[model samples]
Target chain A: MRAIAFKEWLKLRSWLGFMLAAHLVFAAWLYLSIRHQFRFEHAEMIYYQANHIGRIFYDDLRYIPLLTGALIGAAQFLPELLRGRLRLSLHLPMGLAPLVLAHLGIGLEALLVFLALDLAALAITIGSFFPAAFIGSALLTAAPWILAGIAAYFGVALTLLEPRRRYQAANLALSAGVVWLCHRSGQYQAYDLVLGGVAGLVLLLAPASLQAAHRFRNGEP
Target chain B: MTSRLLSWLCLAFLTVVLAAILLPAIYAMAFAPRVAPTHLFYSAVKQDFVYREHRGNHDFTYATASGEHFDRKAFEMSLPFIYYKNMELWGLLPIEIDGQSFDMQAIRDARQVFELKAREVADRHPSVPVHALLDSDPGKAGLSFPEDVFRMKPDRMEFLDVDENRVDPALTDRFTEALAAERFAFPARLVAGKQTILKPFDEGVFLVDAEGAVFHVKRVGDDPVIVRTPIPTDLGIRSIKVQENRQRIYLGLVLTVDNRLFLLQSDGYGLVELPSSGYDADRMDYKLLLNPVHPTAVFGDGGTVTAVALNEDLLPIAAYSRAVPGTTGMIHARISKLLFPVTLSLGTGNSGYLGWTVSGPAPLAFLGNLLAVGVVLLFGRRRRIAPQQMIPQLALAAIAGLYGVLAIALLPGPGPATGATGG
Candidate 1:
């Protein structure tokens, strides 16, 4: 398990770093834009516009997390599945379920770590110039974006392992449903409790992939 | 087989939620009857409820409750207080009201309006309860966002400067001291401020302290002035919205714990609770139109409009709740109830958010569903399909109604997948 975890980490480390750097640079850009509005222009003006008018400055990073999630998930699973290397992974000193979980678990860890750092950057850059409540709302708004990223991970993984195109389409469509569910609310904190449930439900995607893996192993297409 | 079944179960959960939200939306846009919105308002001068609604494309009809009809000019003249300038231009304005010459400027000056939307009330998230106050003193000619907003602690306050991104220790201490002198309990509950960039002048923020005491905090040029404003302790100030008006009669609006609305008196901290009969947090829409004669408030479920007339004292003189004709498509609602087992909607009332609610087709939805099943069954009987295969179809048709029947009809499920599964 340790060897597999380390091996998976090594494979994902550079991609993880890239995701982090990209997100950090993006967060920096968002900060500079807001800072520009505050310094040269009246900071108070932007503050009121944000609270009253419901215009968000961080709209650029709306799908960045989703993009990164897809990339990381594809990188982790596609290379293994494309060469039928998952068959080899099935023989790795563990059961197929636990082994597959280990692979997904490591990939998800990288995604979560990068997301945490990204959220922290948002807090510092935007938080410095705003009150706690405004910052809290902004973060809550970002929750769906982050969830979309995670959903993308499982979605890409499942699509990679599915044998039939029909089943793969179903996988993608349903996964999109979950992501869309997270993003349904524009009101702040509207989905806070429900999103936690959604996050737990996304784990089911890992177990769900077992069916696809079973088919792929048996050449069931 | 188990793995496939499990996967389908999970997928089913997600698909149902999606269908619930989507199918209804699809049905509403495509099948629902078109409803022309009716704009209704009561005119005091006309002494009749006025309504103007579109009769057809690019056509409208204006009417009054007394069966009087009006053209655009007469319509404007009828609500003289609202369209006073237009009435004056057309010479339709009565020179005298109750035999006394009316002052147009005075009427305009007395007009005031404040609106509350359910979305606005639901959208607030806790910010770091820090506030920046501007000096309302005439010596300070312009209004600007404060350099720093202050947060109170026990025996202390901290001012975070936006530009510097650091706490202004000295200013914090000065304000803290002033607040202490006024006997303001530390750690405010509700701190309301007009955080707008450009304002006529600063009206400062209102603060409710830990002990439920209200205090007015302002930056008077170079000095800080904090005054304890008395408010009823039991009022349970849910929210404080500071509305800075030139009149300066009332400072802000307060939403209380008991769901009552009050005008925060600018003369003092006294609250003049509005005569709200059925105003609740769930109220989808609220509109306050301050005509010269009286203020009118309309609350609605996004379909029905309840209009309230307020007298000179801003007390409710009379209020009538009426559902606007064609605001909701009656035929569509009835038809939809029959087609769907339960339709998913984002929100019909207010606070627009995607939420799952059970909505079945109405009118004859159950009957509509039965008819659909009957058609499918009649076909199945002719095809000589096994009774077992038809059971799931009938079951879905019964449960999900029209949507389910349509799904089964359009895309028949691959009865059961065969082939190597967990082989």
Candidate 2:
């Protein structure tokens, strides 16, 4: 588990750095905008400013986890399948379930590490201006994690089902469709429904894809 | 088999989706509170003349007597109590004339006297300041005097005739030109018995009687003056003229004489004695009533009076009064507080809801929660998934939902404390 976590950490380093950089720039922009626009005299005003900044950051940051999860899930799973890496791993001492579970474990670790670093950066930035409310800050810190999990679930299922050029194209088309539907619904709120539906679809599709892979590994035509 | 499994999975997803949507709706419907409207009344007083025409009674006599002086201290003592008891009833806008402060009450009293006396004077001297005669002098009579003139200012004087009408031209042009560039003085005669005096610092209009005592004249309207003579209590209006629709009520005995008129209108939420034009020969000793009739038929302590031409059933067909644009379609019904819910819907089709929407706050919070949950779930599935990975993502989604809940809690709820302010 520890080795798997470390490997996942190494894979996620670049993405985490990007997330940090983006959020830092966003936080700086928020600080400047708030300082310029509002007179921060009272504690209530400072709290309000912090809350506004948090909301803006959260709105933008929400998309990052979803995209990252999908990309990482596809990259890690599809290449292994196309190259028959899973078969080689299965031949080792590990059981099929353990090998699959290991991949899920690594993916989850990367997501959690990225979320923690990003949240810490946000807290430090906002804390300079407002005395942080522990509960509120903690709550805000947790939002990115939820987004990443939904993204990862969909990515895994998509990668497992079709590890080919056609599958890649289909995944891209489906993602675009999801984004289009969310935008046209006139309520970005439908993102949750889409994500949940996609997660369920992936879970349903995963077992079938793995069974086909298992048959191929056993040399059964 | 795969298709059946997929269908069951889809069904499970649909159930979750429905619960997510319905839960927020139920919470909002149960917890949200309502807001109400604020109510208030505003009033102002002015000096004007009231008069009645009697065709064959020409026996006019002039009597000299002292004018009743207003006691400011007495007025001040009664005022605080009036404000405490009837805070919503009276609106007071006080003015100063020669170091004497007069409230709305004084203005109402002054208006009653002026209207009654002006009518008598108009009847007696039908030819005085005759517009026909003045029209003959084109240069001298370019502008018609407003029906009611109340407050006098240095550069401007406010005149309130019957219809809240006003006449204000540059003093430098109108009066200075008429007075041959001389600083105009009060009690100055444009013609004898028909004088237009400039109050001190051009403060107000002070129309004087024959013996040189100042009688305040409050203008009512543009039409020929209409006054009601003392009919025996039993003798009601037999058949009021259709054309002469606007009317005022005057009461009280004459000052220093047998017949006086008091304007029966609210001033600062209470009754006031306004000045009026005196017509009897004993003008100095005479009292006058200058009750200014509101244009609207429905009257209350502080509500504005707008005149409407009603059918025999008292249903309004045509109304003549000042109203803001877009308010012309309003059906003015005297609805009880308890009946507001019923009557509120009756006129709403014609008049758009001039108030806020009740469900505006709920949808915003729900949307926030959805976005938060979607983003967290997406991010949580990224690399190698593990039990630990779910913890952070789940925590974040919960946090976002809490923030949305807090926003909804902060919004103001509904109730009966909202009212529109008058300009």
Candidate 3:
């Protein structure tokens, strides 16, 4: 298990580093924009705009996490599939399930770490300008977006590893629908009621790649 | 075996979710209802309710409760106050009714509009937990934003200075003591205020305390004037809306848990209930139009609209209702129920939260299931799937209907019959 995880990391470390640096740059951009707003405008009026007018000051960060998830999934899996490395990996002494589990586990852990950095940036920036209450609301609002990042990671892997063309297209459609639902909300805390169901659905997608890997090993199209 | 089961469950869940998202959109695209805008008003001259059904731009149909029809010119003359500009242009001003005369100025001053839409109800969107209290008495200069905003806590109220981004301990203690002096309970449940300077004046904030008592709190030149109203502690108040107009006749509007609407008047903070029968605050849109002589309350859903007019004494004078043609009885609507058993939506008109609602499948959906199963059987025969593999495919189609059929078509078994995986 350690060797397999190390192999995955060796392939992903440089891409992961690039993603971390890019995420920090985005966070810094969000922080600077907020500071600039406060420097010019009356703080009270800006507060009223956010509270009453429903202006999302940090909307620039909304799609960054999604892009990070998709790129990292591609970096980790696209080369392996193109070089037929996944076929050799499946024939290792370890079983197919263990091999697939290692790849998903490592990729998911990395994606979560990146998402956490984005959330922390939001917390520190919002807390600097507003009260602690605003921090809580900001986190709740960003929860679904972060969840979408995770779903995108799994979706890329599932789409690439599937054996047939039609099933891949179907998986792509289903995954896009789920991601769109996660991004549908425009206001703060809009998904609070059904967030648990959304998390459950994302969890169900984790094991889906294993079925595709099983078919690939059987030489099925 | 566990991998296979998990995969099947994943496919089933994805299939249902996709159907819920796609089917509703298709159904709406194929068959969505069109509704015409209708406005109701009370004619003091006729002493009855009259309404205008707007068919399209520059096209209107006007009728009264007594079956009297009117053209565009007659309709404008009937509701004189509504079209007072036209009345003035046509030299029909200074109309007398009920032993009183009203000109354009008098009509403008007495007109008050209170509108509540279905989407504006409780929990529809998130609000900032803290509120800025505009100075009610700005003295000469005009109303300006306060330097600090206040938040409600369980035991007391806290004030935070926006510039400093910290609490103002002195102002917080002062306001908390004022509320405590008036016996205002801690941890306010609902707080309503218009945090804008665009209004004529600031009436401050109206809040419902934990004990269900309503209180008015405002800032007057660096001091807080808190008044605890005589509103019943058991009114089960749902929400309060504060709009500061020029008249100062009322404080704001109050909605109760039992769907009762009331006016929080300024005359000693009296609660005057409006006649709101056949109104559902959660689903229907509400509009209250107040003129010099009467107030008309209008409630409309998609299918039906009802209007009730009241005298100055707040007694119901007459009521009129109209039925709007909707798509519920249309052929496409009934067909959609048979095609898609359930739908999933991210947000609803009544709430900002995302939720899943599964409508019970109609009995006709069984026929859809049967047809889908037959199609799957034929497809499997063409693919030459073994009897063992075909059973689950048929069962999925029979149970999940079109969703399952689509899933089966998208994902078929391995190329011939591979016994098992070498891995």
Best by lDDT: 3
True contacts kept of each: 0.26, 0.00, 0.67
lDDT of 3 by residue, A1-221 (tens): 88878998899999999999998998899899999999999998899888877788888878877788888889988999889889989999987777897899999999999999999999999999999888888888888898888888888888888767777887777777777878887787778778898877877777877777877676675
> What's the DockQ for every one of the candidates?
0.35, 0.01, 0.60
Better DockQ candidate (1, 3): 3
Better of 2 and 3 by TM-score: 3
Calculate the i-RMS of every candidate, to one decimal place. Answer: 4.5, 27.4, 3.1
lDDT per residue for candidate 1 within B1-423, as digits (tens), equals 465446544544455556777877887787655556565666876766776666333567787766788887767666667777877787654545544454567667866766666654523342334456665674645766666666665557677776666777888778888888888776666677777646666778777888888888877765877778778767787777777877777776788777777888878677876756677755545666766666677666645666777776778777666555652345666666665667765442454443445654455767877887786677667676655766656666566666555544433132343321111
Question: Which residue runs does candidate 3 get wrong by more than 4 Å?
Answer: A93-95, B30-33, B36-78, B83-101, B320-324, B386-388, B413-423
Q: What is the C-alpha RMSD of each candidate to the true structure, in Å?
A: 4.3, 28.3, 3.3
lDDT on C-alpha atoms for all candidate structures = 0.68, 0.33, 0.81
**If you assessed candidate 2 against the hidden native complex, which CAPRI class would it receive?**
incorrect
lDDT at position A100, candidate 2: 54
Q: Where is model 3 chain B poorest over a 10-residue stretch in terms of lDDT?
A: B414-423
What is chain B's TM-score across the candidates, in the order shown?
0.83, 0.17, 0.86
* lDDT digits (tens) for residues A1-221 of candidate 2: 56555755665566657755765676566456544433434333333223322233234444555556665666556656767765676576655545555666576556555555555645564444333342344333434244444445444544364333433343343333333222222111223223444344334433323433333345332
RMSD of candidate 3 to the truth, in angstroms, is: 3.3
Query: How would you encode candidate 3's per-residue C-alpha lDDT over B38-63 as one tens digit per residue?
Result: 77677888888787775433556788
